[model samples]
Target: MTANASVFVEKLRSVVGDKGLVTDARARHPYLTDWRENYLGTALAVVRPATTEEVAAVVKVCAAEKVAIVPQGGNTGFMGGATPDESGREIVLSLARMSRILEVDTIGYSMTVEAGVVLKTIQEEAAAHDRLFPLSLAAEGSCTIGGNLSTNAGGVQVLHYGNARQLVLGLEVVTPAGDIWNGLRALKKDNTGYDLRDLYLGAEGTLGIITKAVLKLWPKAKDVATSWIAVPTPDAAVELLSGAHAASEDNVTSCELMSRQGIDLVLKHLPGAADPLTDRHDWYVLLEWSSTRARREAGNEGGLTEKMEGYLGEAMEKGLVLDAAIAQNEAQARAFWALRENHSEAQKREGPSLKHDISVAVSRIPSFMREGLAAMKKVLPEGRPVPFGHVGDGNLHFNCQAPAGWDKARFMKHGDAISRAVYDLVVSYGGSISAEHGIGRLKVDELAHYRSKIELDVMRTLKRALDPQNIMNPGKIVRV
Candidate 1:
């Protein structure tokens, strides 16, 4: 270990006590690696703080020692945001022990939760109070609120609820200099200057470490209608989405588009999972609508179901929808959701792949897909272009899997070439390279390359203004 690391470890252990400090290699293994196992790291020591105050104190010690510290929360990120570098010089400051739901103000329609609180737990707690925390993700069970905020996670609900940035009302963050900023207010209106909360929301622990957050909540939906539909192409899926939007604007909570190859991958990997439709189609859409009013108040009195049926009827007549299956009950709804949610997992099982989280205008999604697929196919070997995700929000996971019997190493060897082709097309189409996940270490170079000179300079200015020493999550989001 470096002399600086030894000094930092000593100081960290003193602040958090021996019980909270992990020095053993095995104990620190989990924190040293990321969720996807693509980026493994080595830390001087993993320090677990049980409270926000303890986190501040730990940061203070690391700051005093001039040691770089990476704030980690559940380490469930996809882009290596929480993983450290190979130097083994930085300390992993973990907030897992600070797990607490500070308050749930049902009347105020908000919940104050510590960064360590698991996303799924907060959802359940909100449900217990008959409210809904709409920031949902597949990793909700293991991912922490801090990671979600850092990444500005947009799961299947971005259509109705917006991303994590929109859901957050306030945040309490510990700056890189070890000072705490308590901005955890549930107020909807706080135009007190520049939006500091936003800078940290998707900063990926570069500017500060999020300690607590106040998140917006919605009235629990009492009635939901979910349908899995097969479409001829991405264009048809986009048309179907337009139909749903015309039918129910804000009530159409989710509209996900999946390709045929994506469905086949899921079926090949996951057990007991079947194709939703009888005939194979190039694309599919999972659309859903929810109502705050109960079924008796909605279907019987408000004509909610009739409106949905009418919309589907018109869509079918237009030939936008090839085949559709509306979920008969909650069980069937979950089954349909399972097929959509398991896309990432199934893709992982396929083998080494080049993943791209991209977004375009909702109307131009089909064009982006056609152009992006052609571009990727040109550079890549006989690979599979599995583009699927929240078409309602225009965010697509345009990932590439190798062809059958293809060598994983050979496919991954051209990962950079594949990424360049896709990202270049995305930029040409007025799209964002990252739709949900932030520019963590995985996309640091991409940020530097794609970001304009002025924008990159401003980001650097902010990083230097907030963290001059370059201690907090170095080589992430923006580097010093």
Candidate 2:
């Protein structure tokens, strides 16, 4: 290490103590690479701060020496948003040690937690109080609230509860200049000017580091109905979603679409995974409806389950749904959901693939999927397209697998071209290139190519104003 880096490391060690600082290459490997293993980076040192005050102190030392800080949480992001570069000049500021669920206000319907707390922990804490923290994701077991807020994570429940940003009431952030901005207010209304909480929520840690947050919660649902339905095409799935919303009075908690191939992979790769429907169809939808009213109070008054069944029966009669199977109990519901949750893992077993996380208007999803698939096929005819995800919200994981019998390396050679074609179609449909995942280094160039000049200019202005030295997670979101 250079003299300056050595001095910075010494100061960081002093702030976090020897136990919190990791300099060994092997020890830092896990934090430096992303969950997908697509991004590999090297850092000067991995520093774990046990408290917000320690975090600020570490940042202060790093800022004084003009060193880059890559703020990391559970490190489960598909994008390399939390990963450092290979320059060895950056320090990984991990929040794993600062995890603490500080407050749970049952009456207020809110919870306060430190940044490092796992998403599942928050959910369980809320549940113990008969409240629900509805930000559910596949990585909930390992992903941190700080990372969720940084990326504004959207999961299956977003159809009803909205994304992570919408669930948050306030945040406590450590600015790039090593100053603390305490805005952790749990009030429902404070139409303050500029809304600084939002400015940092989806900034992907480029502007500042989120140290803690006040998150919104809801009453636990007493009635939940999950079902796997078969649809003839994407158009039918869209119609079914609309019809279900009308029937349930907007109580539809989740609506996920799966291609035939997506399900086949799950059954093939995931042991004991079964097909929910008797007959196979070109497309499928795993939808759920939930109600908070007690079953006794909802007796014979058309609860969520009755509403869901009535809607599905009507849909089947109208030919919108080809077949349907509703879960009889909690175990059955979980089993049905396992099929959807295993999509990414099952696809991994197939081979190397190019994945696109894009979104369009709900009404335009059918067209987007049709056009996107055709565009990708035209570029690489032998490629297999697996388009599936939260179709209720218009976000589809448009992933393409290598043609069978071809080596992984040869298939990856066409990844760039396939992605360009798919993204171009997404743009044509007025869709975002990145739906849930933030634009880390993975899609930095695509963001530049697609975003308008004024948008890019505004982003750069904010970056320069907030992190003038470009030391806070640089080379992400916007290039400064």
Candidate 3:
């Protein structure tokens, strides 16, 4: 190590104590690579801070030494936003030790938590208090709230509760210069000035480190009804969603789409997986509706399950749905959701594939899927498309799998061209090349190419103003 780097590590170790600093290569391996193993980086050291004050102190030392800092949470992010670069000069600031639930205000319907708290812990705590924290994802068991806020994560419930950004009411951030911005207000009417909280919420740690957050909560649902429906085409699924909303008074909590190829992969790779419907269809949708009212009271108003059944019956009568199966109980509902959540894992077992997390307007999802699939096929006729995700929110994980008997490496050689073809179509439809996942390192160039001059300039200006030294998560979001 360089003389300056040695001195910087000593200072960081002093602030975090012996247990907080990890310098052994083997111990640091997990933090260096991304979840998908797509990005592998080296860092000077990994530091864990237990409190907001400790985080600020660590940042102060790093800033003084002019060292770049990469604030990492659960490290379950799809993009390489939290991984350090190859230089081995950046410090990996891990928040695992800072996990804590500082406060929970049931009356205000909000909770304040330290950044390191696991998302599932928050959800459980909220439920214990008879409230609900609706921000959920496949990795909620390990992913932290800080990472969710940094990436602006969206999951199955985004159709009802909104993304991580909408669920957060305030934040306590440690600026790049080692100053704390205590904007952790629980007020819902804070229109006082420039909304700094929103700026940092999805900045991917480029501007500052989110140490804590005040998150919004809702009443726990008393009844939840889940259904798996088969549609002849993507357009029919879209039409069915419209009819469901109209019939259920917008109570649709989750609406996910799955292609026949995706389902086949799940059934083949995931043990205990079963086909939810009797007949096979080209496309399918898994949807649910929830109500917080008591079951007896809810039943008096025909209940959420009855309403969902009525909606599906109407959709089937109109030919929007070809077949349907509604879960009879909670166990069955969970079984239906297991198929949707196991998609990523099942695809991993199948083979290496190129994944794209992109979105378009909800109304244009059908057209985007149709056109995007054709564009991708033209690039690689042998590639199989596994297009599925939250159709109600228009975000699709449009992934491409290698054809049978083809080598994974050889198939991946065409990944760039296939991605370009699909992304170009996304741009043509006035859609986002990235939906829930932030830009990180993977989409930096694409963001530069697609974003307008004015938009890029404004982003750069903000980065420079907040982090003049560029010591906080450099080379992320914007290249300022």
Candidate 4:
């Protein structure tokens, strides 16, 4: 290490202590790479701050030294947002040591938590208080709430509870210059000046570090129903969902669309995974509906299950659904969900893949999927498409699995062309190229190219205004 880097490490160790500063190459391995293994970067050291005060102090030191800091929480991001650059000058600021649940306001329907608190822990804490924290995803077990808010994560529940932005009421942030902005107000109707909470929620830590958050919570579900159905086409899936909103009495919690190819991958690679339906179909829908009303024991209508059973029966009669499998118990419901949640892992095991997180108007999903598949084939004829996601919200993980036995190096050669075609199609449909994943280092060039000049200018202007030193997660989101 250089003399300046050695001095910087000592300064950081002074604030967080020797235990907090991980200088060993083996110890810093996990912090340097992303979850997907797409970005393996190098850092001067891995700094673990136990509290917001420590975070602010570390930021102050980095600011004074002009050394770049990569603020990471859980480091489960797909776009390489939390991963540091290859330059060994940057430091990886891990929030793992700061995990804590500060407060649970049952009456106020809000909970305050540290940024490093695992999302699952927060959910369990809220549930113990008879409240639901609806921000959920496949990575909930490992991903932290800070990373979720930083990326403004949207999961299966987005169709009901909205994204992480809507799930939080306030945040406590550490500014680029070490100033603490504690706006952790539990107010639902704050008409304050510029909404800084919204700015940092999806800024991907380019603007500031989210140390703590006041998250909105909802009543726990008393009755729930989950179903895996085989639909004729994407159009039919959309129609099925359009009717489900009312059939379930607006209790539709999630409506995920999966292609046959994706399902086949899960069944083949995932050991415990099984086909919910008998016959193979081109399209499938994993629909869930939950209501706060508890189901009474003695009644012909058991609960959401019976209601959904009737709804699916009608849908089948109308040719909207070809076949279906409704969960009989909670375990069965979880099994149904497991198939959806295990998609990422299954894809990883299958082979090299290109993930496109795009979204459009709900009504336009059918047409968009049709055109998107065609566009993918046009760009890379051999690319096996495995498109699936929250169809109810118009966000699809339009992924392209590599052909048969193609290696990563061989398959990634056509990634750029395929992505360009898919993005152009999404743009033509008035959809977003990035629906949930922020424009981290991976998509920085794409953001510059696809986004309007005015939008880019506004973003760049904000980055410079807040992080004048350009040390906070430098070379991420937008370069100042």
Candidate 5:
């Protein structure tokens, strides 16, 4: 430990008090490691500040001591964004104790929530008031609202409602220098310059810490329809998505593509998961459409299930879909969603894998899958490339599960080489490398390689301008 280490700890404890300060190594284990267990880091201590002002004070002390503050929420980020470094030079500022639902204005169609509020809790609170909070993710049960906003997380609902950044109206951030930037408002239309809210949305805490946010909400989707369709290939899945979109126009909410391999993995690895169709197909899509109860009462055309049935029939005739099963009630609807949401967990049980969250143009999704999967197999002969995700939004998980009975370490050795090959192809098709997960420590190099020089320069400039000291979440996002 440094000569001044004890003094630093004493100051931090003074800021957050003894109850909020955690210094034991065992107690800090959960905060030091990421959700995927890919990155195991060490921290001087894990400090929990219960309010935004307390967070600011803690950050201010750390900045003065020239110590790094790793802003963590839920520790549920997959890319190691919330995890600290192995050097043990940083302090983990956990927002877990800042769990407060500040306000829920149904009339304004928005809610102001503290950063540590569990995502599922916010959803339930919204539901209680007859409103919907649509920033849903697989980790909704454990991930905090702050972490979701930091990563700008995308889930199955992203095809219908946008990602976390789009759902947020404003943010309250603690700058690196310890000043709190308060921009919390429920304004739908703000013609402000630069849209500063976006800067913090996906910054991964490089510029500042997100303490609270004003998130947009929607009227509860009462009349809803869900379907699981079997398709011949990714090409066929694309056709089905287009057909459904054409049928529902604006009402089409969720469109997710699932590979047969992905579904099989889910059923085999995850309990209570089942195939909705009797016969297996190469690919499948779970789609949903929704409308408010008031809208449903106005006309028969508003019935999403009937409209989807007609669309499916047309798609079958056109050879776009082989067969499909539309959920008849809420119970079946939940079951269908379970199959899609259980993908990551199921894949984990299969083996350690190289996961990519990349996106291309919607029209190019099929081609990207065809070419990308082929390229990956060529590099590693025994690789099982499972490409599936939000086909409607053109984002594919494009993960490669290790071949059966292969050495886990040896297979993982080629992770970078394989990532390079896949990312190169994505760029050729004008796609993004880090689609939903931010460019945390994991993808920093990938971002440098795939991002244009001009874009990198702009990002660096922004980071430098906002965080001149570079004390906020060091070694994340931009290299600065």
Candidate 6:
């Protein structure tokens, strides 16, 4: 290490101890890249602080040296938000060692936790307290709460509970200037001054580092019903969901849409993942309804399954559903959900792919897919389109896997053109090019191009005002 880097390392070690720092190249490799393997960066050192006070101390050292700090949590982000740059001058501030569950207020329906705590752990803890923390995604086993708040992640349950931002009540953040902002209040309504908690929630750690959070919770579901249905088209799936709200009495927890192509990939790659139905169809929907009340009887009177069956029968009569299967038990329900959750892993194993997390108005998803797929095929005729996601909330992972037997270098040649076409179509439909994933150097150019000038100006102004030195995750959402 250079003399300056040696000095910085010593100061960081003094604050977090020798065991908390990782300087060896091999030990630091995983933290240098994102989950998608799209970015392999370099860092001077990876600092693992075990406490909020230690985190502030490390930030103080970086702020004094004018060195950039890349705040990372679990490094599970798809947009490369937590990865450092190739310049080997930046220090990676990893929060893996700081995981702790501080409090669980069952009566108040809130959970207070450190930033490094895994999401699944939080869910389990809430369940132990007879409560529920509903923010869930595929990577919940490994993804951290800090990163979830940083990206404002959206999962299947967004159809009912909303996004990560809505699930959080307050946050505790460490500013770029090495100061702590303690706003971790479990208040249901805080009408004080500005909502500083929001400013740090979706900033992707560019504005500040999230150290802790006060998350909202709800009562656990006592009775649940899940279904796997074959829909003839995207429009049919939408119509089915529209009719389900009234039928399910607003208990629809999740409603995911998938193409037959995506389901085939899941069956091919994911072990133990079986197709729920025997007959293959062009489109399918994974519908789930959860209720806080227990079942009144074994059959029809007030059972969740009976209500779901009734809805499916009505939908079939209207041609909205071609075929359907309601899960007989929890195991069957999980088996059905495995098909939807394993989509990304299966796609990765298949080949190089272009994944776009775009969104449009709920009614315009069908038209968007029609034009977007055509535009993509016009560019790469042999591309394999795997379009699926939380269609109930209007977000679709409109991804395209590389053609069969095509290498990464070869398939990526058509990536730019395909992405441009899809993004253009999304813009025309008055939709977002990015729904949950932030810019995070992946879509920086697209964000600049698609977002209005005034909007970009306001974001840049906030970034500059809060993180004036540009030491907090530089070259992320903005180019300030």
| TM-score of each prediction | 0.97, 0.97, 0.97, 0.98, 0.97, 0.98
Mark the regions of model 6 whose C-alpha exceeds 4 Å error after superposition. 297-302
Model 3 C-alpha lDDT versus the unseen true structure: 0.90
Q: Which 10-residue span in candidate 3 carries the lowest summed lDDT?
A: 293-302
- Writing each residue's lDDT as its tens digit, candidate 3 over 1-480 gives 888778888888888899899878899998998887888999888999888888999999988878899999999987799999999889899999989999999999999999999999999999999999998788889999999999999998998989999999999999999999999999788888899999998899999999999999999998788999999889998888877887776788899999999999999988888998877889999989887876578334657788888888878888888998999988898888888888888877888788899999889999999898998899999888999999989999999888877767899899889999989999998899899988998888889988999999999999999999999889988897
State the lDDT at 151 in candidate 4.
93
List clash counts for every candidate, in order.
0, 0, 0, 0, 0, 0
Instruction: Please give, for residues 1-480, the per-residue lDDT of candidate 4 as tens digits.
Output: 888778888999999998898877787899999888999999988999998999999999989988888999998888999998897888899999989999999999999999999999999999999999998899999999999999999999999999999999999999999999999999988887999999999999889999999999999999999999999999999999999999999999999999988988888888888888778889999999998888875562588999999999999999999999999999998888888998888999988999999999999999998899999999889989999999989999999999999999999999999999999999999999899988788898888888999999999899999999888888887766
Using TM-score as the yardstick, the better of models 1 and 3 is 3
Error of 6 at 244 (Å): 0.3
Give the alpha carbon lDDT tens digit for every residue of 255-344 in model 6: 999999999999999988887888999999999999888897444366789898988998899899989999998999989988999999
Using alpha carbons, what is the TM-score of model 4? 0.98
Q: Give per-residue CA lDDT, model 5, range 374-414, as digits (tens).
A: 89988997888888888878888999998887667888888
Residue pairs clashing, model 1: none
Residue 70 lDDT, candidate 5, scale 0-100: 91
Between candidates 1 and 6, which one is better according to TM-score? 6
What's the lDDT for candidate 4?
Answer: 0.92
| Model 3, runs deviating above 4 Å | 298-302, 405-408
Candidate number that wins on lDDT, 1 or 3:
3
Better of 2 and 3 by lDDT: 2
Residue runs of model 2 more than 4 Å from their true location after superposition: 298-302
